[model samples]
Target: MNPKWWKESIVYQIYPISFMDSNGDGKGDLRGIISKLDYLQELGVDVIWVCPIYKSPNHDNGYDISDYCDIMKEFGTMDDFDRLLQNMHARGMKLMMDLVLNHTSHEHPWFVESRASKDNPKRDFYIWRKGKNGGPPNNWESYFSGSVWELDPQTDEYYLHLYSKYQPDLNWDNPAVIDKLHEMVHWWLKKGVDGFRFDAIAHIVKKEGYPDAHNPSGATTVRAYDMFSNLENVHTLLQNLYDKVLFHYDIMTVGETSGLGPEQALDYVGDGRRELNMTFQFEHMNLDAASPGSGRWDVVPWKLTDLKQIISNWQTVLHGRGWNANYLCNHDQPRSVSRFGNDLYYRIPSAKMLATFIHMLEGTPYIYQGEEIGMTNIALESIDDYRDVETLNYYEEKRQQGVPEEEIMSAIHRKSRDNARTPMQWEDAHEGGFTTGTPWLRVNSNYAEINAANAVKDPDSIYHYYKKLIELRKKHKVIVYGEYGLLLPDHPEIYAYIRTLEDQRLLVILNFFDKEPVFELPADMKQGGMQLLLSNYQAPKNDDLTQLKLRPYEARIYLQQLEGK
Candidate 1:
């Protein structure tokens, strides 16, 4: 395997709006991010993948870009961004900006002109189609909760929007649009930006024609992802992007490819593919959904076996064929500790255990903002406390469907994106020290117990555990490049795997639930000469590896030496 900076580095994802607030505006800005450089450096992360800071109308937060060339005023001036980049580079950390090219805000000049008149030069820049039967062009559903098509009054045509109607989909088939996007990418690269995390990249290329989905009744807002995800032309477009611009810069790129399996992912991130360094696959993220056809709001109890299978499949398939971007939570998902671990009684142990699982995996581990401190989900009493468009839209849609108010609220509590968008818990002070003014979103009510200040002060806190995990990854090449092998594959509550690189082997045992499960070594495995590499709990006095009982959310990593090597 070849060595690359991105492959060996740890990425920290920051939702800038919720990260910090330097001014009293209640919104986190570039200057606010600049203020936290020391704290990020202390976390031992090599790259900071910030969510969109582009100029936007804030319909879908910053994902709906109005101006590609300018920074959002709420985020701060371009000068502040330049300083942010400089400071990150000074601290030996790279900055990866979120690139939302699949769509642009309806307020964008191109979209504005496109919607103005039929003969507008920029009309073809966006996907505009005539209505089929006094309704939207087709029965496609918006990701947020509505028809994908929105009728424009002036043009008397419907424009495609996979997300919110405020975010109009761009026409990737148009050469002019492609040229404009490429130019903008180069503009950022020339400004010394390190890399980009492509948002909704898989949805860039749609089906050959605007085909209607199989849904006869388009009342429900359920998306047929196959209609516009991971199309063949996407690879061609990405290859062109690589040849024209990305080839000139030594930078990293990861696509938000939600619908790709391991084999399909190779088309984008495989070695020498000239498309991307890696891509974020959503297979693991969707395991907790109630059913295959169910929406995200229909949450269910996820099993440890299923998680192991999904993760193992990705790891084993992408071992050397492509690369993986390992993560459990991000800006669009709920907190990992709250969703995947026990955030009530076993918050610290489970958080540490989750960190161990991610870092020990064979990929570049991405740590979301509050993840290092074991931040959990917020259960606001009313739906009014939520600020995420997705959550709000779901609430309204369910209410109209006659779903019980309590059930809707419960689902929101479990699956709302706002759970991850809360202000960073910097301290236990007002608004968790994120800002002196009111926060754009409510702070997690548990901030008093989960703030970063407390974590930093305590040696045994999740923050320190994360810092130690990162340090181990830096010291042990096996953690980054090793081949993964699943152990105890059928174990209900224990998730265990071994990473092997040459003579070095690392055995990772994790108790996924709050049960004391006995983990017995397999027959073929040797137990001699094993050294405890790291553990969330204290080192056990006994060296017997044949059988051991695990504590609730306990995680252990042991280094074993081959006989004579």
Candidate 2:
């Protein structure tokens, strides 16, 4: 196994706008993050992946970048960013910036010039096609809802935007565009940035001939996943990116591959592939949809068996082939404890259980902001309380389709991105100690009980459990490079696995439900001396593993020394 620092590192994602607010501006700034370096250092993370802080119109919460080289004014100036980087490096932590290379904001100078006139030098910077049938070039749907094409009356043409219309897709086929993006990446590397988390990377290359996707359900718009995701040419583009820029810098790169599976993922991050270090696959993230291929908003009860299958597939497929980026939730997904764990009844044990599952997996584990303290999803009273563009668009679309307001609100409560976008609960003070001024989004009403201040003080808090998990990873190579094996694969409530690295072995047993489940250990697996490594609940009095009854939302880890070591 390759021994890289990032491979063994734990990543903590920081959505800057909601992380911390400095100067009472109702927004998180670089200075705010600077003040909390000690806090993160205490959490024992090796790398911090801060979301986009570049110049943007806030149309997509900083994802729509208007300037790659400049910092968003609300996030503070370039000097503040420099100071933030300096402080992070001083404290032995690395910084990973979010790179949105697939598209640029419409207000960007290149796009502005591209839309000016057909003969302009930058006219080819963005994908543009003449309108067909007096409508969009294709019936493809925007990821945020509505048509992917936006008509520009100036030149009687339409531009392709896989996301919001303000975020126009860049023409990667154009060499000048590729060159400019590569230069921007080099500039950041020169500025001492350690790595990049590429956003919407699989959608960078579009299929040949803007073909209309077949909508079997006959919806007005269709998600043309095959047309824009993981195209044959994307690998070539990524190779060029790696050879020209990323290869020179010792940096970590993880691509957000939305519509990819484990087999296809190998093409991007395989041992010899020069594309990326790892990929954030969405297969497991989509298991809760109402049906196959249904969008995230169409919620359904997720099965433990299905989750186990998905995770086991990824783990086994990428064990020695490629790398995996293990995560349950991020800025785009709902909180993990609320979605997968019993947030109300067993929040503490469930949160630790989920943490143990991910941290013990064969990959670099990412802790979304506030996840360590067991943050739960927030349900705003009305749609107006939400601020995410995706949530608002879904709400309007469903409302126009005659769906009742209550039904739409219920779906939003379950799946809206804003649930993860709320300001971090720092304390029980005003606005969860996120800001002295009005927060951009409403703080969760339960913040008084679930703030980080209380978690830090309590030794048994989820925050400390996460700290211990990270420390264990640092001390044991088995957690990082151990080969993974699934146990009790068909069990309904127990998700168990074994990690083996030569003579050392670790067994992890998790109870996925709110009821106690009995797990029977196979006779062949009981030949070693077992030692309790960790557990969410108190250690059981009996060390026998023959027929163990696990508590609700319980998690246990055991280390075995074969032949008395």
For every model shown, what is its TM-score relative to the native structure?
Answer: 0.98, 0.99
Per-residue alpha-carbon lDDT of candidate 2 for residues 1-565, written as tens digits (9 for 90 to 100): 8888889999999999999999898999899999889999999999999999999998999999999999999999999999999999999999999999999999899999999999999999999998788788888998998899999999999999999999999999999999999999999999999999999999999988999999898876898888999999999999999999999999999999987789999999999889999999998898888876678899888899999999999999999899989999999999999999989989999999999999999999999999999999998998888999999999999988999999999999999999899999999999999999999999898999999999999999999999989998898788999999999888999999999887889899999998888888878888867888888887575567898888899898888875654
lDDT of 1 by residue, 1-565 (tens): 7889999999999999999999989999999999998999998999999999999999999999999989999999999999999999999999998999999999999998998899999999999999986888777778887889898888788899999999999999999999999999999999998899999999999988878778756454447789999999999999999999999999989999987789899999988899999999988888888887577899778888989989999999999888999999998999999999999999999999999999999999999999999999889999988889999999998999899999999999999999899999999999999999999998887888889999999998999999999999999999999999999888899999999988889999999989998888887777457788889987664456787888899999988876656
Winner by lDDT: 2
lDDT of 2 at 303: 92
Task: Tell me the RMSD of model 2 versus the true structure.
Answer: 1.0
Q: Looking at candidate 2, what is the lDDT of residue 167?
A: 99
lDDT of every model, 2 decimals: 0.91, 0.93
